[model samples]
Target: MGEWRDVFDIKRDSAPVEEIAARIDADSTVKGANLVILIMAIFIASVGLNMNSVAVIIGAMLISPLMGGIVATGYGMATYDMHFIKKSLVKLSFQVVFALLTAAVYFSLTPITTPSPEMLARTAPTAWDVIIALCGGIAGAIGNTRQEKSNVIPGVAIATALMPPLCTAGYGIAAHSFHFFGGALYLFFINCFFITFSSFLIFKILRVPVCGGVSEAHFRYQRWFLIVCGLVVTVPSLYMAYVTANENIRDSQVKSFISQDMDLEASSVVAYELDHGVLIVDVIGAPLDDQEIERLQASLHQYGQLRQTTLKVVQGPASQLNQEQVQEIINARLANELKNDSGKSYKELANQYYGSYKRDAADQNLLRSLNRQAPVLFPAVRQISGGTLSTLNGEEETEGRQWLAYIVVSRQLTADEAGRLQQWIQTQADMPVVVNIQLQDTPSQFYGNGIDWNP
Candidate 1:
């Protein structure tokens, strides 16, 4: 026991209380350079999240001063320094407000409104996040108290990720998305509380001296109060963590069940979403019958986490006949019509040709309108071909029609441009239309003077 005590003693390398206090004193005051760094960090993190760049996000994390205020607050609480605690809290609050405002302004001005994976990942906080924050906090406190500080502080900053979640919350606010705002804010709260609480615990364990002379009773009361506050913050986090863990388990079980039992040749799962004890699975290629679906649902009981959950199977929209199938159907119809046009006049033959096929007057009008508008909308477009296909539902192709357009373009269309064209066409037709664009490569230019350039 004595050997173990000597080996595990934290005070052996601990810095003096005065030194630790001075180091965090400047950090606890949010002004000048500290304030500037906080704002810059927020902007960097928000941009990284908006662009979905992990490297940029990590760079932002390294320079973030958000952890300073949190550590100061925790240190103050540990030492029962009222002045220090009050200053730290005020500075921390200011840092949070400024960071959030800066992020919101940046996101509001930016044109890219799509949510990236990096941003989305911060919105959901699990029990593992709380655990990580707590562990990081302990590490941060230990590092701060060391006589010779290593890179542990910066590593803690990156691990805790103090800036990203706040920026994500700001994104939610800027985009007017309450779901994103709420989830991200919750995650940020979890990080702040757990980090501070863990720091307080570590400082107390290190036996750091209190600032002022106080009675034993008063110190004990303050310690209990801090403990209560920590407990209050932890309860909701614990519950949220449990819920997140259960959800992960459920998702894993569902994936395992599908991969192990489902027939991949006949059908394959495209996507799935779980909500309120229900799993909605979207499958393509082949539809599952009632009996097969029931068997699959029964098989889910083997996973204890999903025993009471309901499985709802939905067929994917892409299960319909593809471009090849549509072309085949049109070719067969045209062949039959040509074979039977033995005694028809020129005008009659034209009418017969149009009527035998599924191309009606409305379709022709729409096609003419598209051709007239295509060149105006996209100057690079060389030619356009469009046709209608019977809608496929389950094993049957019904009278319902869907439009398909094939565009030959002189240049490759950007994602935004393609999306805009598709939207415009769909609006004009007052229905959904699938547009596929093919780029026509331009020939390379060559000079006889041993020079070749392609643009």
Candidate 2:
């Protein structure tokens, strides 16, 4: 038990140059392992990023040789080992290159072009990243001081999270995504700087020896090197800090305005996105009533300058809505109704109630089966007697065997429009499938009157 605790403590301790150097040189095969592990790590990282697999990404991070380079660099700085510094830099650069090249090649070969959620996630860095890096660096330093490395390696792997950003960079290369490149590279740089600098601090604090006798010239050289490294790291940190501050300000303003103007009686205003300095709001149903519009405008005007506030409103009909949006609206309304007794979300409720059309997969299969068995030409030669199949309850019944299926369209459709639709459906086939048409009555009513709910 004592031995286990000590080993754990060693894994959680920080290190000096001598200790780190001994560890690096102890394993005769470490250098060779470094090369293989790094390449594999980078490839895994890229795949994980592309697929948005968090577990795969973490596994890649665990296998990455990145921490060794940073550790070596810090050790070099502390002990003034120029050879170690060069070796570490070369190894780190190779790892990075391998990762990037691997990503580029993999993505080029893989047929999937769509960005996975993981890929999208790594496309941005936030202040929280800085916090994570800082904490990780501190923990890494502690782990280094320990003799047992059970926790150190895992801690370093988790804290560094090196694979994600590198993989992100690879995604950029593969997908021609400049945004991915910039964001990912920036994140990688952040990790590199923090890890190396933190290690440097930990070493200096532990009073790691400089190997040779202290000379004024050597001391001055070391001081200058430290200063240069500090400058290099600080530049990006400061820029990231500024960006984080700006994002926070914009987010605060948006939330403040939305919260302050909750009294607006306008049609439900759904927040879509702020793009090109415009807010895209989904206004379900018809345009808001005059009173509702006035209330909305009045409330908005009080919160911010209304001159540049371009709000793109989208109006939709209940009949046009598919099941997903209808259900979403229903859920939103239900939540609102549960909170407020006025039932302001009743319009959404109504939309959901009317829009809930149960689509049957089996029906689609049946249509496909019928279409295959009885190849009918659209614009089926219609006669006055009984030439077309009727759709009375939103279901089409037909045993079409001709070039096209003759459909009895609803009377709501004009002859010209019906002919055009038949022509359109016919075009999908190689041979002309003429649709023979007839007029029939449908129970469903067209709904496009007015806004019914307040969001």
Candidate 3:
């Protein structure tokens, strides 16, 4: 047990206090080679962010001296060296400004204006980023105290990501977008604050001897300023965390509703998105008439997450289907199912999806034919729409082809008129359909509230 405990013992391979202090002092300055490297790193990171290249960004992080300066600032605080604190702060500030300006120039001159995924990623600093910065700072400080210099510093630099956020802020400046500017700057500040604070904690825990410096009064003012800044940074992250959690929960609930509750058999829901309070659904396979759409919109009320969401069902025009779009739909579905069943080939899945689509398309054509004949058959009939449906028998798989029809007319239909229209529909469909004829608020539109079958 003692041996196991000793593994975590931090003092076992401790560096001499003098050596660590000397090392931090060397890292604190931003001049000569450090300045040059900072410039190069800034340009590289900017290009990486613009191109959305992860490898280039990681390469840039490996060479960044930014973390070194941050650690020096933390070390200065631990030792109560007000002179050293002021010096390191000035150097770090200079380095950050130079880095941001260099990145801004590159982004401004370059023709690439689109914000890539890499750039967008750094703009949002979440709670996890804070935790990562803290862990990295602790690890880096412990590494600095080790007798044998390890690679922990570079790894921490990569993990905390000091360079990318600044570059993103630069991009924001170039683009003249305050949202991007504010968000990226906030993220960079989060990284800097936590790294310095956590490193201070580690250095204090190690009990490094105080190397006194001039201007203790300045350090006190700076300390209080940092405390205020920390609070300012932290409050927004807490609110952002709440919003992120809420969105995740809402997403999960909506996904569950789509999988379990959405009951359109003849049609397939290809894609869906919840924008604000509106749910946009794109579907293909069988036809969808007014009633199906209304039922679909009504069903949103059943799910708590979707109760306030407005549903918009989009069906492609009844022209020829786009094979490529259908292929994308099929591929998405098979990607999930094929994970469990490796034996199924893409060809087989494509064939199955297309076969179903062909049959559905034929049924849709039949419905359209009936719609075209409606006005001639009954002059008062303003609109007619329909869709095909399938059903099952008790404990048996049986073919139950059902069709639903909605007819809208300008005026009321008598019993004789309604009967004649129903017979004409059955004859046109060439199938027995159960349609409930009703009289309500008269028809002025295609889908909602009004209708009769005859003139």
- C-alpha local distance difference test of each model: 0.76, 0.60, 0.77
Q: Number of the top candidate by TM-score?
A: 3
User: Rank order by lDDT, top first?
Assistant: 3, 1, 2
TM-scores for candidates 1 onward, in order:
0.66, 0.64, 0.66
Error of 1 at 356 (Å): 32
Model 3: residues with Cα > 4 Å off, grouped in runs: 1-7, 213-227, 256-263, 285-291, 298-304, 320-455
| Model 2 misplaced regions, further than 4 Å | 1-19, 26-30, 213-218, 241-271, 289-291, 301-308, 316-455
Of candidate 3, the 10-residue stretch with the lowest lDDT total is 338-347
Q: What's the CA RMSD of model 1 in angstroms?
A: 17.0
Give lDDT tens digits, candidate 3, residues 1-455.
Answer: 99987887787788888998988888775788887888889988998999889999998898888987888889888887767778888889988888888888888999988787677777667888888888998999999889988999889989989999999998888899776788888888888888888888888878888775537676678679778977887888878878767777777766666666565677766555566688766677677888877887787677776689888876674244585676665676556444322213343546756766776776678778877888888887766667666677887775677666677666667758777887888777777664543333543333533323343
Predictions ranked by TM-score, top down?
3, 1, 2
lDDT per residue, candidate 1, 1-455, as tens digits?
A: 99999997878898988898888787666778977887788888998999999999998999998888899988888888888889888888888888888888999999998777788778777777888899999999889889999999899989989899999989988999887898788888878888888889888998878878878887789778867866766677778778767766766786677668665667765445455678766566667789988998998777899899888887644449453443443344344433432111222323433542445556678888988998898786677677776677787857477778777777767677777778887887777798767765543223111111231
lDDT of 2 by residue, 371-400 (tens): 543324323322211122223434554434
